[model samples]
Target: MVIFLAETAQVLAQTPQSLKPAPDAEAGAQAYADNCARCHGPTGAGDGRDSKRMHPRPRKLSEGVFKFRTTASGTPPTDEDLYETISNGLPGSRMPDFQRLPEDVRWQLVYHVKSLSAAFQDKPEPLAFGKDPGKGANLAKGKELYTQLGCNACHGPQGRGNGPSAATLVDQWGDHIDAANLTQGWSYRSGSSPRDVLVRLMTGLDGTPMPSYAEAVKPEEVWDLAYYVHSIQAEPRWSSKVAAVREELGWDKAPRTDLRLSSTFYRNGEIVPSSVRAVSVQAMYNEKEILFRLTWHDRSESRETPSDAAAVVLLEDPNSRWRSGSLRGWTGKTEPAELLSYEDGEWTALLKRPLPSGKRAGLGVMVWDGGNAEQGRHRSNSNWMELILK
Candidate 1:
C-alpha cells in the first residue's frame, strides 16, 4: 500500500494541471507592477520610460501582437503558450527568464498579461503540429526546396539573412525588422531545436513576414527544410585576448583575431542589433608604437555628411572617461592618428597609437553606419577586450 501511494504521488507531481494554481490576475497586478512595468509600462503599452532607447522594442501587451506563438498566424496564443513564455522568457532579448518565481506566481503573471489583451478573451487553443519525419530529413532535397519556396529571397541562398529582400523587410507595426541570421542558432526568437524550427515552420510568426509552410509544403517535407536550416547553424566565435605581435614590417604581418560586435545602448543597458555585426582586428607593435587594423563588411557606403566611421577606443580601466578633444598626445598633436578607406562594400582602417605603460590595457572598437542613421551612442561597439602588450 505504501508503494502504491508513492507511485500515485509521482504521477501527481508530473501532472501540469495538478501542479498549477488557480488564476488570480488581482495578485498578478502587483507582481507585474513590481517586475514588468519598468519595461512593459504601467498599462502594458510598451512605453515604459526605459523603452525609448530599446531596439525591437518591448511588446505592447494591450495590442496582443505576439511574435512567438503556437497558434495560427494572426491568432492569439493559447494559455499554455503564454505560461511557457513567462516562465522561460524570450531569448536574445531584454526579457529574462522568470523561472525563479514560484509556479503559482508565474501563472498569475500569465493571467495578468492575458487580461491586458482583449484578444485572449476566448482563450485560443494551440494549433496541433503534424508528425515530424526528422529521421528521413534530406539535406539535398531541403536545399532544393529552400530555393523553390522563395526562402532565398529573404534568408539568402546561404541562409545568412542577407537575401535580396532582407533590407526591405518590416514588421506589422511598420518598424524595421532584420531577418534571422540563420548561422547563429541562439539568436532565433523562438527556441532553436529541430522541433522548435518545425513548429515555427508550421505556425508562422504573427507580427513578422515569416509565413506558415503548412500549405506550401507537405508535412514530411517541412522536416527536410527544418533539418537543412538547423544544419547551417554555426557556433559564433568571440575572443577576449588581443595579442600584439612584434611586427616591424606592417599590419600584413600582424596576428589577426576576430571579435563579434553588437549594437548596444549603454544608458539603458540593452544589447540591441544594428547593421554592423562583426569585425576582424589585427594588432602589431614595434619599439615606439602599436597599430590596429580593423576590417569589416558594410553593404552600403554610408559616407554622407554624417559619414560612416570607425574608431579604436583605448582605456586604462572600465571606468576611464573620455576627456573630449582627441586622445591627446598618444596619437601625437590634437587629432587622432587614424585613417579609414572603403571600397566594394568593405571597410579597412589603420589606427596608430603610442605604447602604454602597462602589461595589459583595455581596448574597444566602434563603428558608425551613416546610411542606417546610426550615430553618437547609437552605434555598434565591442566590449572592452584585454590587449596584451609584450
Candidate 2:
C-alpha cells in the first residue's frame, strides 16, 4: 500500500497542470451576451450596431475566419489562440484585452465563440509547416515561385502590395483591405516569423482574398518563398561622405531598421490608427552632411490628389517635448529637415540635414498617404528616434 501511494504521487507530479477549466457552454452564452454582443452582435454575424463605424470592422464569428493564429489561415485557430486574443487583445484596433477576467471565464468565452460557427463543430486539422530553407539558395528559388504563383497579381512584383488587383480587393464584409506588403514582414497581421509566413501561405487569411497555397506549392517550396519574401526587406545605408550622385546609395548595401506604427493617435475628435503600419529607415553621413533614406509600402503612388510624402524632424534638445496627441514639434517652430521623395509601388525619400555635433540629435519620422486621405496633421508618424554620429 505504501509503495502504491508513492507511485501515484510520482505520476501526479509528472502531469502538467491544465490552464483551462472544463468549459460550460451555458456560462459562455451568458458571458457573450454581457461582453461581446455589443461589437460582435447577438448573432455573431459581425453586424453589431457599432460595426459600421469601425475600419477593418469586427470579425464575423459565424464565419470562423480569424486573422491571427499559429495554425494555417483557413483552419480554425486552436482554443489557446482564441484565449490569447481575448486576453491580450489586438493592438492598434478597437479590441480591448480581457486579462482581468478569470482564466476559466476566458475559456468559457472561447467555447461560446466557437459555437457561433459550424466550422468548429468538427476540429479541422492544421496544415503542416516545414523547416526553413536557409537564405541565398532558397531565396532564388522562392523568387521564381513568387512569379509562377501569380503573387504579383496582388502583392506586386516586388512584394510591395501595389499589384494591379490591389485596388479592387475587399474582405468578406465588403470593406476594402489591401494585400499584405510582403516586404514588411514586421507588419504581418498573423505573425512575422518564417514559420508564420509558411502558415499564412498554407492557410491563407480566412474571409479575405489571400488564398492558401498548400495544394499549389510543396511544403519545401513554401520555405523558399518565405525566405525570398524576407530578402526584399529594406535596409539602411552608411557612407563616409554624402554621395554626389543619389543613385550611388544602392538600397541593397544599406543597414535597415524596420519599425511598426501600431499606436493610434487622436485626430479630429476621433481615434485614427495608421493605415500604413510599417516603415524602413537607413542612414548615411559625411563630415558635414547626413542623409536618411526612408521607404514604406503604399498601394497607390498618389502624386496628384493627395501626393505621397515623408519627413524627418530633428531637435537639438534631447529632452524636447513632442506629443503624439498634438502636432507640435520639439520646440514651437523647429523646421523639418529638407525632404525629397519618389514613389513607385513604394514611397522612397531622402532626408538631408547638417550632421549634428556634440551629442546625438532626436529625430522623428512621418509618412502621408494621400490615397488614404491623409494630409496636414492627419498622418502616420513615429515617436522620436535618437541619431548617434559615429
* Candidate 2 structure quality by residue, lDDT tens digits, 1-390: 000101011001111337567778889999888888888998899887666545668888988888765466567777766876787665445666687788789889988999999878666565556656655347778899999999999999888888889988999878777777777554445445566566668877778898888889888998988777767754423221222222355556556665544334554444555667666777777677767787777788666646666766665544554533344442221123333454547666777667666356666667776787732223676656665544
Candidate RMSDs in order: 7.7, 9.3
The TM-scores, one per candidate, come to 0.76, 0.71
User: What are the per-model numbers of colliding residue pairs?
Assistant: 0, 7
lDDT of 2: 0.66
Report the lDDT of model 2 for residue 252: 64
Per-residue accuracy of model 1 over 113-173 as CA lDDT, tens digit each: 9889888866554666666666677978888898999988887767767677877889887
> lDDT scores for all predictions?
0.70, 0.66
Off by over 4 Å in 2: 1-20, 26-53, 67-81, 84-103, 122-125, 128-137, 230-270, 280-292, 322-344, 352-361, 374-378, 387-390
The candidate scoring highest on lDDT is 1
The 10-residue segment with the lowest total lDDT in model 2: 1-10
* Clash pairs (backbone) in predicted model 2: 73-203, 235-256, 236-254, 236-255, 236-256, 236-282, 237-254
